[model samples]
Target: MISCVFLATCFVAIVADAHEAHEPVVVVDSDAMRQAVLAWRSTLGPELTRQASFEFAGPVRTDWHFVPKDRLGVNWHDMNLEQRRAAHNLLRIALSSQGYFKALAIMSLDEDLRRLEASRPNAQNVRDPERYWFALFGDPSSDEPWGWRIEGHHLSLNFSSVTGQVVSVTPAFFGTNPAELRDGPRAGLRVLGTEEDLARDLITSCTPAQLKTAMIAETAPGDVIALPGVEINFGEPEGLSAEEMTDAQQALLRNLLDEIIGNFNAELRERALDELEDAGFDKLHFAWAGSVEVGKGHYFRIHGPTLVIEYDNTQNNANHAHLVWHSPDNNFGADYLQRHYAESPHHQSAK
Candidate 1:
């Protein structure tokens, strides 16, 4: 009997391993990916760029920033199957193309990653070839669902996808130190050229009357007003609505907005565009701050029903750039959360 029991256990272990090995890998459609890549590249225009490639093997081998194993707020083991899948998908997206761009943005910095790793050994270690250390607390196993953070300097993205839905994508940040350079081997490099030029041109093109409404304040804020952890309160819609603009002006605004928000994948970009359309162009508020002169510290913000874009050209004598797009209602697919909760045991049991 003892021999039989031991043999049965071994069989079960082998089967489990086989099942894991055969799990379907997430395969992004190449054509779809190509289109998205092209759209983003077109926005970049001609710029000095480099390519880096990586292949991840599950969470175990994924590059993640390290944090104290005890402080990880997620309990992955407690999440159901669907929850686990969603969490994995979110992490995959975070680490794939978007994550790659973040790394590339800072790759130019001399010893930036090395210094961060040394100063914060626990917080900055890269665990696997594809995974960097950026968490503090429990491991990201299927056993427990826990909050996890993946950050490295200019790139800081946090996610808490539990029970088959993403909780948040806040503190999602992207910044380029050298927005544009006048000298270097890659001289006249402008990483985010379209993002800057389009908006500037739109504002400059506005009639004096339009500028009166678009430029809410003459002063530029020292930093982005909507910092992390703050409740997103969009002030009243305050700009000349698209309906009010001349056809040419309207076209420019649309093109500029497209260039700004097209940084995401196709699906997300479509959703954002739809939201913008539904909100109506008249509802948007465009506010500017600081000097209007190029190469000077300046900032602009666009707020509408489904979009909020903040651009700051303040660092390095207005050469450094920061831009962000946020949707108050749909960030991290808040709509998906309602569906997930409806099926959750916690909600079902309460009902």
Candidate 2:
């Protein structure tokens, strides 16, 4: 009897290990990843690309403003396997776009990786790790869900995952201090022209009444209201919704939203769109702040049932730029949690 019991225990342990091994892992296609990287590389000139690779690989510690270097951002802890994979690819493509200044952004991330790694040598915290650190959380060998974070000065991309799906991809913050270089070796460089122009066009297109509804405040908020540790509340939608606009105006709104949302690929973009569609056009709002003039400090926000986007270009004589895309229900994989917990044993007992 004792021998039989021991054998049974061994079999259970083996089965558990096998189950864990079979759990889905976030696997990215190397070819897809390479294509994204190359696309961004092509945007930057060859000389800048070579320099960017070098700078990104070098040892340097960038500043950490509001959050601790080791602490993960809020929403990164809840994504599932597939969502995490999509988030990783989305961020890689966004950061590696073509253009000398855009290339610098990638290089800066690389440097941050080296700095983090050097500080934790045994941990191998290089750019690849730093850029996608959030994907490594939880048991790499277990079937249990886990979370990860990607953070550094001027960049924070956080996503959470469960079994194998993404739950949240915000509060994502992307900013550039010098939006354009007025003087330097790379003189007259603008890192985020498309981002800046889209917002401006949207605001300028608004009618007097539309502008009245959209302009939430006269002054820029200085910085993003939600930082690393703050609990964010979805403020009530304040601007005009798509339903209020004519077809031409609606198209303009979509064009601006797409410019921002399209940073993600087809699948993720569709997911965002589905959520937006369910919210309906009447629930959307747009709000603006700061200067009305181009090339000056300014900001705008678009709010709806499932989406919140903020853009500010008020620093460095409207040269600094910051933007964020967030979803309330989807923040940090909250949707995944609902689905997961509902099926969990604990949930069944509570019910």
Q: lDDT per model, in order?
A: 0.50, 0.53
Position 315, candidate 1: lDDT? 77
TM-score of each: 0.59, 0.63
How do the residues 99-170 of candidate 1 rate in per-residue lDDT, one tens digit apiece?
333334333331333342456555343321122223321223232222345444344454434342234443
What does the lDDT read for residue 55 in candidate 2? Answer: 16
Q: Lowest lDDT 10-mer window, candidate 1?
A: 48-57
Taking the tens digit of each residue's C-alpha lDDT, what string does model 2 give over 180-266?
655534445454567677667777888898888777788887765555455557567776777777677777778777766655544
Error of 1 at 318 (Å): 1.0
What local lDDT score does residue 193 receive in model 2, on the 0 to 100 scale? 66
Cα displacement (Å) at residue 124, model 2: 22
